[model samples]
Target: MRRSVRSPYTIDLGQLHFSLQYNNWPIGYVESTNDNITIHSGENAIQFFGELQSISSESYNALSTVIQNFLTGQTSKIEVLAGPNATSYPLLAAGIVGLSLNVHMPPFSEQLIASLIFKSMSLIPSTNTRNVMLSASITIKINSPLGQQSPLNIQMMNMSVFLLYENDSVGMLSVYQAPVKQL
Candidate 1:
């Protein structure tokens, strides 16, 4: 006879909350994966995938601004705080160090249907905060096409920030307005 076992770790997206400008956008679904084999090479990683339906243009605009700021080497970050925690983690430490985004936009629609994909790695020798900071590279994909043209693809790199975790949820925080540089 053979013995079988099941992993005890799991995440419920329903309990997860993601926000921009204090406005919470309802997430339709979330999917995540962990790669244990990569651990041997010192690259143990987990990937999160999700979709947000019926997002307003205003909300999407806010998201676009944040992405643009980070990509331009400006001081930009996204705050993430998991369940019941008052502390929100700021992604991208200082001077663009730990994150990336890929955006996809669909063509011809009354409202914008966007797909965002974020990817990043865990920070080595973690931080001392109550939350854990991950070295992450995120990709936001917008599925909207451009007037009979193909969809748009944008990539941003090097965002350093902390990721707070509580039970099984996560959150992100960043500057809502563009920061003015002082000389």
Candidate 2:
């Protein structure tokens, strides 16, 4: 007579640990436990409700911090590791060890400057003239994650912008005082 047997290997998934980072800066962490985690097999999802203190520093003025707090508060990098119990399975630990992050940006459009020179633009066309004169002002905007809903402030500054085509300087955009805004 032949007997049937089944492998006892199984993973709880709740025994996994996740470390999240934003733009190479550590942000927060999530530890899954049997108590706070529930595995939904039918839905193919794992739900957990718990609290972990943020690991970011308050003194540092890094760009990651600004993006997380003010802008898009999303994890740009993630490191997955096996918990104490899950480490016993070498195969599972080997497969889940790495830093991987996926970010999907939706369609976005915004106007940087209302007018090119703060006035009407005039383009003159001449039959025999090959040289064209061009002047422009530039403004750089750093919008919050909330987009246009953030506060608005405008300031003016001077900067040099060059336009090149085919590795050759086609024109130069010289701005004496260009308006700059920060939110």
Question: Which parts of model 1 have CA positions greater than 4 angstroms off?
Answer: 1-31, 34-44, 50-54, 81-183
Q: How does model 1 score by TM-score?
A: 0.25
Checking candidate 2 for backbone clashes, the offending pairs are 155-180
Full-model lDDT, candidate 2 = 0.44
RMSD values, in order shown: 24.8, 13.2
lDDT of each: 0.36, 0.44
Residue by residue across 90-182, what tens digits does model 2's lDDT show? Answer: 565566667354433222233333344333444554578765554433334444333566555557776577879998997775656655644
Q: Which candidate tops lDDT?
A: 2
Ten contiguous residues with the weakest lDDT in model 2? 1-10
